[model samples]
Target: MRAALAALLLAMPAAAQTGDLVATDALRVCADPANLPFSNDRGEGFENRIATLLARALDRKLDYVFFPQVQGFVRNTLRAGRCDLVMGTVAGDELMQNTNPYYHTTYVIAYRRDRPVPERLDDPAMKSLRLGAIARTPPIDLLLRNGLIGNARFFPLAVDTRHESPGADLMQAVADGELDAALVWGPIAGYQAKVKGLPIALRALPTEAGVARMDFFITMGIRAQEPEWRRRINTAIRDHQGEIDAILRDYGVPLLDAEGRLQPP
Candidate 1:
């Protein structure tokens, strides 16, 4: 029976095998080709810079299997064997085993410097503002629970960000006086505000009673079968801490410490 099982396992597809999935010649990355601040075909995003660091540390050529970050992204890229790693994923996501978290961030509400928003989502002031939040993200729940969704605008997620940056656009709306405030992911809001020089201000959403999580730890994703590879990459992350932090800093990512305080430049 042991011999039969060994033979059966060996006959199964390579991806199903419990083995080191790291490629010998390259760091094959699964990335969205047009997702700015995260990745793109032009290799211009922070994840691309991190991918280069990882490839160098592993002594492998960097290669990317470009795909849009749409439904079935993992199924089409990593699990389909087009690549061996995803550069960024929310830690604890059920779809992939995660590496040690590299960064912590939170949702932030952005508005024009002159237009103030309620610090807490449950504030009664929220109900009066013309707010915008992504349709399916955490803010929507808070927006609804506080009865603030009446005048709130909902933007769709998973668009080709190269063509449509809903988060940045919403921030722009705030700066242009089209909207009162917009709650969005921190990195996008910070990066866009800096790069675009929008007259917008951002405030991190603190943890609140009876509210959904506003913060997340981000990690690289690996196949559940690739524990060894995960360790190797984790070591790479430790070895390149300064470079990684600098890359994120360059991209204007809003980083938070374990206690949820913002990191200063």
Candidate 2:
């Protein structure tokens, strides 16, 4: 029986490569070709830079499969074996298992600098202020849950107004004085607002549990069955911290510490 089991184990296709990862060949990465500062096939995104570093560490070439950043990208690529790993992913995203977060991001309130900053999201002073937010977005949901505003006054149409590119519009509205403020992804929002000199102040809001915030770190996703691959990826993250930091820095994505404060690049 022991001999039979040993034979079976030997015959099984290796779920993930094992042993010294430095000797490994290539890391198949799933990425989006057009997304900036993330995974893109043009070899310009942060995820792409990190992928290159990881490949070098493992002594492997990188095999990137580009796809749009849309629903089912994970299922169709990484899950279906078209790619071995996802370059980056939200930690608690419902799609796949993730490794320890290599970095965290902040979601800040971007408002006209001339306007009064609310002490908190529920502050009474904000009661009459028009805040632009993306429809079906987490921030919008948080606002609704907090009873921050009525459905009619939200913007770009109304509180229920969803847009394919709401973040861009939301920032533009704030710049144009169409809205007093908007809650958006910190890195992207901060970058755009700063580049445009929109005269906006990006402030981190105090958030309650379960809402995505600067305090929570995001992680990289890997195939669940590939424990060895996951370990190598995590190891690469630790070993290439400086390179990763630089990549994010170049893209204007602030690296946040455990307390959610921006850290020095």
Candidate 3:
């Protein structure tokens, strides 16, 4: 009887052996422990929520390899094989295989509610206000082209890996009266302004020249060798796009449709 059973199992299709051949263990994700709106150690960010949803769809437990999202982040975590996936990355990033873009967003202007918020880069009001931006970011170049660089306060883009995100600091400055306005990434600014309850206004920028094109499509990052894994993830993303969009909405992400209109959740 045992010999007959072994022969029967071996004769079954390859698909029938998928459970034994493929590992459905934990989904090990690489994330920043302190990057809010994306991820954090406390699992309060949108990326954390997305990770959870993906793991559930794959019928696997969720786990994280926490690292700061500074220089050498990929080398130390994903490339080092400490984790099998990164939940959030630019779609065209060359460092790893990327899944289909899950969301698109643009840079935003953040300012205290008590002050005037300029909807466009050329607003006359921008010239009189104290502008702030992260160094080397697209917004800085916009400021330069507009002749606003001389008065703009620049925050460093690269900080010690141990430090908190400088993006948060720039947003906080707008809320704390340190800056009249700030140009920051849309998701971060939206999360800070709407979700985090900061007293600031967040507005999307209108398309303009020399603005470094603030928009971007974000995707999940996987190792080059993980083509099958990437396909699975892409399937998951496609299957659960509605749920994913809801998660982004809950986190106050400024989502944009293909036509560039604001997609209200």
Candidate 4:
């Protein structure tokens, strides 16, 4: 029934293994204050909406420690005793225990709907087109092997996202005809396309096409010692998947089921 979003430490974790990070009175979440379509301080992102749902479901006050999702996000927020939950994490991240995957997504080729769709990175038509991708993402390697990098623009990866929107900038280039197409994470392209009503079509890439892994299953993260907390989150995810899916779809998230079928809203 209550909430707090603070940039400073509002709660501290105990050094001992006593489940101190898990909040008993509030559903405390660790989130990036400015990472849009995922999280933001304004509570407009899908993760913020979902966290609200989780807090409501658990009958706890909603709370957050707002930090940028940078190098020490886990150590400074969830691990340092400031927050209890992270709404989205790669499924197998070693720094924290993960709940059951809540959704699956992949890298995508984003092009104007009026243009010829490129189904894969190796699409022959792509060779002649101006392309864009993030510097360190999986598509860069594929672009290199396909001899497409020479024609591609690679944006800096993992920039200080708190004040930057590299993904949106890259997608906008495609929409503006600066680039014929761009390869970006599905969620980023999808969210921007939906929000701006951009006429972009996104083509999902394979998880493992012998170049680099692209698809990812995203899960909630909690501390390693919180088995019961992890199980609770799993149950929460299972029970509220419909609500979760709706929120993601509302935010233009491209999703796939566990069986790999596209979930189009």
Report each candidate's C-alpha RMSD, comma-separated, in the order given.
4.4, 5.1, 4.2, 7.7
What local lDDT does model 2 show for residue 183?
75
lDDT of 4: 0.86
lDDT of 2 by residue, 28-106 (tens): 8888776654655579767888888888887888888777767678878877777777866878876877977887876
Give the per-residue Cα lDDT of candidate 4 at 191: 92
The Cα RMSD of model 3 versus the native structure comes to 4.2
Model 3 pairs in collision: none
Off by over 4 Å in 1: 1-21
Which predicted model would earn the best TM-score?
Answer: 4
User: Tens digit of lDDT per residue, candidate 1, span 43-97?
Assistant: 9889999999999999999999998888899999888877888987998989888
Give the whole-model CA lDDT for all candidates, comma-separated: 0.84, 0.69, 0.83, 0.86
Please write out the lDDT profile of model 3 over residues 84-119, one tens digit for every residue. 889879888999889999999888788888887667
The TM-score values for the models, in the order shown, are: 0.89, 0.78, 0.87, 0.90
Candidate 3, superposed: residue stretches over 4 Å from native: 1-24, 160-162, 207-211
TM-score head-to-head 1 vs 2, winner: 1
Candidate whose lDDT is highest? 4
Candidate 2, poorest ten consecutive residues by summed lDDT: 155-164
